[model samples]
Target: MHAGGIGAPTIARTLNEEGIPNPTSYAKLTGYSWHNRPSSSLWSAGCIYSILHNETYLGTLCQGRQLTPEGQFHSKKNIPKDQWVRTVGHHPAIIDDELLRRELKARKEAGAHNLHEQKKNFPPGIFGKEVRCASCGKILTKGKTLRKTGCERTLFCPTRKKSPSHCKGAFISEKHLESAILHELKNLADRYSDDRVQIGICQDAQSADLIQEKNRLKTAVELIEKEITAYEQRSRDLYLKRATDGMSIDDFNSALSRIRNDVDKLRLKSKRASSELLHLNESIAAESIRMETVLKAADFNHLDKTKVSMLIESVYVHKRDPKSGTQAIDITWKF
Candidate 1:
C-alpha cells in the first residue's frame, strides 16, 4: 500500500481488501488485552486515520498529554500542550521526517473537511461528563440515532454497546433528559417561592436526627460533669477527715484513690461526649449550608453550563427495566 494515500476510507478499504488485520484484531492475535468491544475490532476510516496521524510512531514521543479528572476512574480529556511531558527517542521511528510532514499536512486537511461536515448535524454534548451509568459507573457518550423523521440525539453507556454483560443500561434521549430536568427544576422553583414550603421540601431529615444525637451527647456530658464534681467534693471531705485525725492515713488514702479513679472515668466519658457533639454539630452546619445553596438557586427554568455546575453534582442513569419501559435516574444536587 502507498504511504501517501487518497483518503482515510480509500486507504482503509485497500488495507481491508489486502487482508490486513485491524488494530484490535492484531492486538488479540498477539496476546494483547485491548479493552474495546469485539464488534469494534473491524477497521474503520476514523480508527485508521487516527493511527496515521499519531506522532508516537516517529520515535520521539510526548506522554501524560491527557488527564482524567481527580478521583474519577474514567472521563479522560486532553490537557494543554504545555502541561504535557515530552521525551525524545522514546521508541524506534517507523516514519521519517519527510513522510511525517506529508502525513501531517494531509491529516490537517482531512480533519478540517470532516469538522465542516460534522457541524451540519452534530448536537452539542452539553452534559458531557455529568451523565453516568449507575451500574458500571462509566461516563455516558453522545451519539445520533437516525429515524424516518430525522436524527435523534441520545446518550448511551459506551461499555454496554461493546458488551452487554459489562453494562446493560438503556440509551437515554437527550430531549427527554433535558425535559425531565426542566420540569423538576420548575417544580422546585414553585415550591421555593414560599419559605415554609421550601423548608419542607429541601430540609434534610438526617440533619434533624443529628441534632437529636447532639442533644443526647450534651446531656451525657453534663451528667458526667456533675458526677466529677461530686467525686472531687468527696476527696476534699476525706482530706479534711485525715487532717483532723478523724480517719486513719491508710483509710483516707484508700477512699481518695477510689474517688480519684471515679473522677478520671467521668472526665474521660465527658471528653468523648464533647467530641461526639462537636462532630455532630459540624456535620449539621455543613449540611445546612449545602441546603441553603440549593434553596437560593431554586428559580431556574432552564439549565446552562453555569446553572448545571451550580445546582447539580452528578446524574446517575440506571438500566431501564424491559417490562416497565421506565429508566430510573438519580440526580444529586450540588448542595
Candidate 2:
C-alpha cells in the first residue's frame, strides 16, 4: 500500500476492513501469550508507520535501539540512531532497497506537508515548544476558539486523538497559563532579592572542566564500543565452531551466553558514557547567563518572550482536579 502511494491511515483502515489480525492478535495466535495486550484490537496508523520504517525487511538486523539503565526497573530509553548496532544483509530480503527508499521519501514528504498545515492553522504562541502535557510529556499545541466574549487562545495536548490510553488530554487557557508563569517569576525574583537562593553561574573554568570531562567520556565510549564488537565477533566464531566442529550443545550455549552477557554490559556502559558526553556538550554550548540577573531585571507583570526564553526551560501542566477545579503547573528553570 505504501509503495502504491496509499497513506498509512488509509492502509490501516483497509486492513481493519479486511478483518486482518493485528500484530498483537497474530502473536497470541502463535501461542505468545506473554506479550502485553494492545490498546486496540484493530490495525492502527502508528503500526503501519512502524512497519514502513523498519529496515528488517531489507535484510538488516538492528539491535540496541533501547537500553535500560543500570539499577532501573521497567524503564528504558531509546539509544541514538548512530549508536544502534546494525548488520546489513543478515537475512534474506523481503523488500527491495528501492521500495524502502521510496516509502521513506513519501513519509518524509507527508510529514513536511503536515507540519506546514499545522503551522498555518495553529500559528505558534508565546509558549510555543516550552509547554508540555504533564501526563504524556508531549508539547501542547496552540489553538484558538470563539466564545461569547471573544476569541480565546488555548494550549491542549494532541496525543489524545491518537492514544488516549497514554494521556486522556490536558487543556489550559493561555491567559491562565501566562498568569501562573508571571506569578512564578515574581516569586523567584522575591526569593533572590531576599538572598534565599543562590544561582550557580557557569564560568570559564567550569566550561573548561566540562570540556575535559566530555573528552574523557568520549574516550571511554570508544573503548566500550570496541569491547562490544570484540565480544560480538567471539560469539559469531563460537557459533561457527559449534556448527562445523561438532561442539557439545551445552558447552556452546554456556560460552555464547557468557559472551552475550559481556556484550550487553559493554553496550550499557557505552550508553551511559555517551549520555554523559551529550550532556557535557549541551552544557558547553549553552550561554552562561546568571539567573539572578535575569530574575532581577524581569518585569513579572506580563509574559516577555525574551525573558521567558532565557529563564525558563519548560512548563508542564497537569490535568485539572475534578473536585477542586485546579490545575498543577510545574516549571523547569534554565539556570
Candidate 3:
C-alpha cells in the first residue's frame, strides 16, 4: 500500500475490511508467547505505520534504541539514533533497500507537509513548556480559535486526542492562565513584603541548621576515611607479621580478611556522607538563587514569557468540575 502511495490509515482500513488477522492475532496463531492484548482484534493506523518504518524488514538488526532506567521498567526513553546499534544484512531481507528508502522518503515528505499545516493552524504559544495536564503530566499543546474580536489562544492536553481516558477535559484559556499567574504573583509578593522580618528570622534559623548538618556530615566522612586508613594499615601490618614474625598463614589471612571487610564498610559510609554533603551544598546554592528570583518577581504587575520562566517552574491545570464549572490550577514556583 505504501508503494502504491496509499496512506497507513487507508491500508489499515483495507486490511480490516478483508478480515485479515492483526500482528497480535498472527503471533498468537503461530504459537508465539504473546502476553498483551490489543485494544481491538484489528489492524490500526499506528501498527501499519510502525511496520512501514521498521528497518528490520530490510535485513537490518537494531538494538539499544531505547533505555529503561534502573527500577523504571515503564519509563523507556529513546536513545539518539547515532547511539543506536544497527547491523545491516543481519537477516534475510523481506523488503529491498531501494523500496525501504523510497517509503522513508515519501513518509518524510508527507510528515513535512502535515507539520506545515499544523504550524499554520496552531502557532506556538508562550506557555507551551510551562503548562501541563495535572492528570497525565503531559505538556499542554497550544491552539487557537478565531473569535469575532481576535484569535483566542488555549493550552490543552494533547493526550485527550489520542487517549481520552487518560486526560479528559483538560483545557484552559491562555487569558485565564495569565490572570491566575498574575494573581498568584501579587499574593506572593504581598506575603513576602508583609512578613519580611519574620521570614528573615526563620530563614536565618534554617540556614544555621543546614550549616550544622553540613558540618556533621563532613566530620562523619572524615572519621570514616580515618577508619578506612587504619584498617588498611592493619592489613599491611598483618602481612608484615606473616613474613617477619612467623605468624601462621591461616591467622594472617583471617586478620587480613577482617581488616578488608572493615575497610569496605568504612568506605561505603564515607561515600554516603560525602554524597549527602554534596546534595546539601547544591540545595543551599539553588535556594539562594531561587530566593533572588522570587524577590525580583514581586515587582511584576504583568506577565511575560521571560518573567514566567524565571519565577514559575510549572503550571498544572486540572479537569474542570462539571457541577461548579470551575477548574483547579496549581502553580509550582521556583522558590
In terms of TM-score, which candidate is strongest?
Answer: 1
> Which of the two, 1 or 3, has more TM-score?
1
Task: Give the residue spans of candidate 2 off by over 4 A.
Answer: 1-124, 195-291
Q: Rank the candidates by lDDT, best first.
A: 2, 3, 1
lDDT of 2 by residue, 41-73 (tens): 667778887877788878999999999989997
Candidate 1 positional error at 135, Å: 4.7
Candidate 1 lDDT over 148-176, as tens digits, reads: 87878889876665445445665897877
Q: List, residue by residue over 120-236, the lDDT tens digit for candidate 3.
A: 876456685888998878788777767797778887776663444445748888888988888777776554454432332325556567878989999998888888888888888
- Candidates ranked, most accurate by TM-score first: 1, 3, 2
Model 3: per-residue Cα lDDT at residue 256 = 82
TM-scores, one per candidate = 0.60, 0.39, 0.46
Q: Which residue pairs does candidate 2 place in steric collision?
A: none
Give the best candidate by lDDT. 2
| lDDT by candidate, in order shown | 0.73, 0.78, 0.77
lDDT of 1 at 213: 89
Name the runs in model 1 displaced over 4 angstroms.
1-47, 54-111, 114-124, 144-153, 160-169, 182-213, 319-325
Candidate 2 or 3, higher TM-score?
3
